[model samples]
Target: MVTVQEQGDTVVFTVEGWHKLWAMRSELRIPRTHILGARRDPEASKAWGIRAPGTHIPGLLKAGTFYFDNTGDNKPTFLDVQHRENTVVIDLADEEYNRLIIEVADPDEVVALFGPAAAT
Candidate 1:
């Protein structure tokens, strides 16, 4: 699981446990302005076409970077989700990752951080 913490103008995502190895990094900091919105999307990583530099264990785990080949845009995604049911898709702009599909202990709290206008 991951923990979301808002610090000033940035939002941090802390990857916990062995997920740190799977994701290749322990923390990610994105400027609050770069966060377009967020939503609870269990199937957010369902169509991830390739695991470029990440790890996946079928229905068990999907951590690291993935690309959406079907979209042509090849939208890059960073995923650290163990359970689909507790995933949140956070859309971003002008950032390294186009989106983040991660599992948080309380999805509601994370979504609320972006506010109603930012929740799609």
Candidate 2:
């Protein structure tokens, strides 16, 4: 699981517990301008294509960096989701990770933070 918090003009995503090792990251900070939007998209966590440096256990957990395709330009995605129901997808631009799919306690609350235009 991951925790989201807003600090000034940046949004912070802190990886919790063992997810840190799987995701190979302790935290990610993105400028507010880089955030495209966010949405509740549990299904997005399904069928993750290829994991370069991450962990995936079929119906269990998915944490780390993943690529949807082999194409070189395919930006990677960071995920830390165990239960699909609690997943929220955050889209970004001009960042290392193209997207973030994580399990949060309250998906609705998180989505609301990005506003209605954030649904993607």
Scored by lDDT, the top model is 2
Tens digits of per-residue lDDT for model 1, 11-55: 999999999998887999999998887888898767656787989
The digit string of per-residue lDDT tens for model 2 on 26-80 reads 8999998888878888888885578888899998999999988732568998899
The CA lDDT at 78 in model 2 is 88
Task: State the C-alpha lDDT per candidate.
Answer: 0.85, 0.86
List the lowest-lDDT window of 10 residues for candidate 2: 111-120
66 Cα displacement, candidate 1 (Å): 0.6
Off by over 4 Å in 2: 70-73, 117-120
RMSD of 1: 2.0
Clash number for each model: 0, 0
Error of 1 at 31 (Å): 0.3
Q: Give the number of colliding residue pairs in candidate 2.
A: 0
